[model samples]
Target: MSGVEFNRRLESIPVYPAAESYGEDEGLIKLASNETPWGPPPAVIGAIQGQLETLNRYPDPAKSVLRRRIAERSDVPISKVVVGNGSCEILLAAGDALLEPGAEIVYAWPSFSMYPHLAAQSGARAVEVPLANGVHDLEAMAREVNAATRLVLVCNPNNPTATAVGIDEIDAFVASLPRHVAVILDEAYVEFNLLQDPGESIDLLSKHSNLVVLRTFSKVYGLCGLRAGYALGTEEFRLAVDRVRQP
Candidate 1:
């Protein structure tokens, strides 16, 4: 007898290791997640408290307020921004809009583990370009692109390793890719890198119509509980992702 069939990729995908809870007396320290040691600032707490009255109400369908604020901060038009639960949701939207069977999603390994899972769930092939000394091998990744490639994910200051590719390096990589393939610059950890040398990928978006920059309040802003994040890209690309984003 045959078992019920589902997407085959689901069987091989790695599960995210969730942090286990501990009793107050256990003295067990949870380190599996990257949660901040401190709580959000007083202003943020007060702002959240002010929204208590609206707890029963559904959030705005368009996420207009947050979208406008993100647009102002990123200096992009508001129409180009799509706010979501977190940047991960934006990545999922990218997968839904761009990936399918026989399609490809190229990214660097030793990076975000979610990239492969996202690609697989979308029924797309995941082409991992091995990192060069823990940083993204942009040149090699560019070489992996072909007509069937739909999306490329570049996690700047890449996860786990905390290494980043410079602006010039990425600018050249995006320029080398075909127009049909869209690129997502995962900048979730960008705030940490901005202190010494702020990257200019966002500034270069005007020239590269295929690039999308993702950011989140989960890290530096200490808003992981709120799950606020957004994407900055061309209006067309944002709309494409929005088509898959739940209203």
Candidate 2:
């Protein structure tokens, strides 16, 4: 044994429960990871294949082209966009950039497993409010916010349960929080949301500078292997998180 010491804070963080694998099982349908039933479009496959010849070179560190496309689609400025390996990376970066010891991070319990892990990894206190009727209890979450609170993560169309909070409710929730607290709206499965309009959440960014919305191409777009995702927020927020991102 190397007798190497890991970060002691890891002792308090629970292991993320990844979905069990059924290796090489034919004709089996797996829904645990929220992957798309179909493969990516032919054009997407062609684009990726077309780039294979340039594999010797590193990708654009700024990801300017993709960021510009995403910005145009989201109707946000390109400076406001920060791309990541995946939305999960964006989440982790947000925690690293915003969370610290004595700071508190709030999110709905029984929601995404990453929230608790992110809090522990950052040495921040986690305030996990129990979900109400399989959905995020926004009011309870807002009440948990105190002066110590630095980050709030709302997983709309929340994992495991697939229920989403409405846009009006989100607007009210943001309006209730203090400006110092940054809110992360993780819309990882938003494309699958049929109950309410998914685009409405992006509109909140204009009204709340402290709010950021995260999206990924992994779910509906079937690009899980590509690990493409991004966050839309103010230029200041993007810069903060970008500083913590890997080159």
Candidate 3:
């Protein structure tokens, strides 16, 4: 195929996920959704406090400090990092940066709905392949990916269900993918993902230039309110994502 022939489902979607209710004035524990419960580390708090003096000034739009902190922790080089208001911003930025008018985004249906939503916003087609056996079916996913697929999402240790494939399984699946098609591992809750070794994605990036890994301080570092998150990959992919950060 010479790319997608149609794009209506994603391009014309009208609804966006919104708060079903704006309930009481902060009186709920909000366990309806999972949260870190523990906030940012004391050191992070100190750093944010130090920045309080410059609150009137614009925040470093590039977010160098937070990126550097994330790089230091993740062991990826600082230049390979890009920061945003929240992980969703980075995810949407990836969608905008990577997806063209007819590019197809392939992700699991009961996984993260945002993959398709962001694709719709960018006029890209959402190729939602169904889940299998309560976990990501690597073979099924690979079969669905065609030449038109620009991005493939692997939400390891998937949300709600919290099931994950083995590290080798993930690596093998990534190895089967096209080098030019972006493969994103949404490891947002990896801190709680007791299944596989945490270092797997970092390992994958060294070999696969197409690999993208997303992590957030809102979960393990416990700073969702502060809206800190990042997408990790080779510098090339990060640059591709950064190109769309402007309003």
Candidate 4:
């Protein structure tokens, strides 16, 4: 081991529980991870194959083409879109950019495990509000937000539990929060749980300045191997997160 000291915050972080593997002879089926078992659609395959000719060239650092498409799809301005290797990268970027020593981030307990891990890496406190009956207790979470709280993560259709909070509930929660705090709506599974209207988050962005909605192509779009995802928010939030992202 190196002589350099490690960050104290890492002490509480558990090793990430990765999917288990099996030997060829064992032939064990792997189902622990949340992944699409099927192959990518023909269009996605075609688009990827189309990029093979330019494999030697580096992609546009700005990712303008993909960002433009995500902007249009999310109904957000191009300036407010920031793409990433995956939504997880966007989440990690938020932690790096928004949190500071002694800062706190609030999110539902038993939700995505990464929320707390990201907060810890930033030397921030992970304020976990226990879920009420397998759903986010948004009211409790809002109450936990004090001056030290810098960020909140809401995983709609929360992971592990497979429950979601609706648009109306989200609207009230944002309105109740202090304007200084930023909230990230991790809609990694939104496509599977859309309501009567699918653009609610996009529409809500116009009203909530501190909100960031993250989406990933790994889910319904079936592009897990491509590692594409994006975040849509106000120009201020997007730019701040982008500054921490790897170019």
Candidate 5:
């Protein structure tokens, strides 16, 4: 092998363990990836077919049409929306923009596997608070924050555990954080959560300028293969994430 040097930071990051795949004949319903039980509706399939003619052309780098649609749906200004290949990409972009070697990122232990990787890739310290009975101990997570903390990731209706904190709990948590700390409220499984109001978090954006809400089509919309996701935040935050995102 040619002697090539990789980023030393990558040395500490464990490879993300992807789920196992099965052949069509295996008759398996793979729930491990959190994919929908059914595929997208006919309308969605038709929309994809309509775009087949444009296969040779590149998609709009600005993602103008898609961003406008997401903005209209979320009832937020287009400037506040940043679309990515997936919600995971937005998470990485946030780390790239807000984290450095000395910064710290706080999140609960046994949460999304991606959390620890984010900290490692950014060369930021990972402050993992132990879960209180399989649920994110938000209080414990908040207590871990200090001057060096730059980002806090909260995965509501948390993966692997299906448990969620109420909106009031989230509101109070964000309110408690310092203005310098950016909170990434990952709502990947929000649609599956019947306990909390889905739209309540969108309202929190206007109240906290440092909060960035992430949503994805992969979960509820059955668009995991398409990799469409977006973030809702203040214009400043949107621009910062966009700057670091791939063109």
Candidate 6:
């Protein structure tokens, strides 16, 4: 698939200028991107500096430090977390593992572009559900699910729109889905959720075995460049995603 054509979609995406390129003297308040100007804390920087001598050595493939921390914080088991290059890598890994030609991937439109990109890259059909006032309508999304549906994607506290579907509502949606279908919760922006406790999703995972919760170091940790994120779920599901990930 290396030689696969990208077609016109990639061409259509607008090329916005980087905020970093803005002149130092401009004093621009750039909200066009939500990146945190202040990144890792002083202690984190000091720790990284201490590890600079070992930078030449291969980093942990399992990402033990990050994974254990996330597991302790998330309340999901360690076996459930599968860390990858970034949130995109985890989603793309989901694509590589599950998507096949003619298979279906249902996602909310205008939520995240990567959902469609991964769907296309896997040569699968992409079903984009329209948002209702910037929130995902789980009922409408459920209507699109069929036997051929390989994955149903939900980007909560949705990107570009930044709205959340509450825990009760999200749980109801997961319960409503058929057991055969997999539901991926894309909670990339979840850390900064102001309306409710972010840990609610972790609790929901126990009910729906097919649910895969996605998280990232990019958004809250402010480590998007570090290319680290993880997916948490049952052992079977993590292994299901791992087969596509392992070289």
Regions more than 4 Å wrong, model 6 = 1-32
Structural similarity to truth (TM-score) of each candidate: 0.93, 0.94, 0.87, 0.94, 0.94, 0.87
Residue-by-residue lDDT tens digits, candidate 5, 25-102: 556656668777788988999999999999999999889999999999889999999999999998998999999999
How many residue pairs clash in each candidate at the backbone level?
0, 0, 0, 0, 0, 1
In model 4, the runs with Cα more than 4 Å from the true position are 1-4, 20-26, 194-196
For residues 1-247, write the lDDT of model 6, one tens digit per residue: 6987866545534555676667675767877556778887678778878999997899887778888888898877888988889878889888888888889989998888678777767778889999998889889999999989999999888988988888888889989888878888988899777766778888888889989889887778777767778888888877777788853
C-alpha RMSD (angstroms) for model 5: 1.9
How many times do residue backbones clash in model 5? 0
Please say which candidate is ahead in lDDT: 1 or 2.
Answer: 2
lDDT against the true structure, per candidate, is 0.86, 0.90, 0.80, 0.86, 0.90, 0.83
TM for candidate 4 is 0.94
Q: Which residue runs of candidate 3 sit more than 4 Å off their true CA positions?
A: 1-29
Instruction: Give the Cα error of residue 36 in candidate 6, in Å.
Output: 0.7
How accurate locally is residue 246 in candidate 3, as Cα lDDT from 0 to 100?
72
Return the TM-score for candidate 3, rounded to 2 decimals. Answer: 0.87
Candidate 4 per-residue C-alpha lDDT over 1-247 given as tens digits, one digit per residue, 9 for 90 to 100: 8789987878889986544423455565665457888989999889888989999999998999999987787777899998899888889988999998899999998988788888779888888999999999999999999999999999988898888888999999998999999999998888777552558877888899998889899988778888998889888877887789888
Tens digit per residue, CA lDDT, model 1, 87-136: 88888888998899899999999788788887778888889999998888
Q: Choose 3 or 4, whichever is better by TM-score.
A: 4
Candidate 1 lDDT (Cα, whole model)? Answer: 0.86
Backbone clashes in model 3: 0
lDDT of 2: 0.90
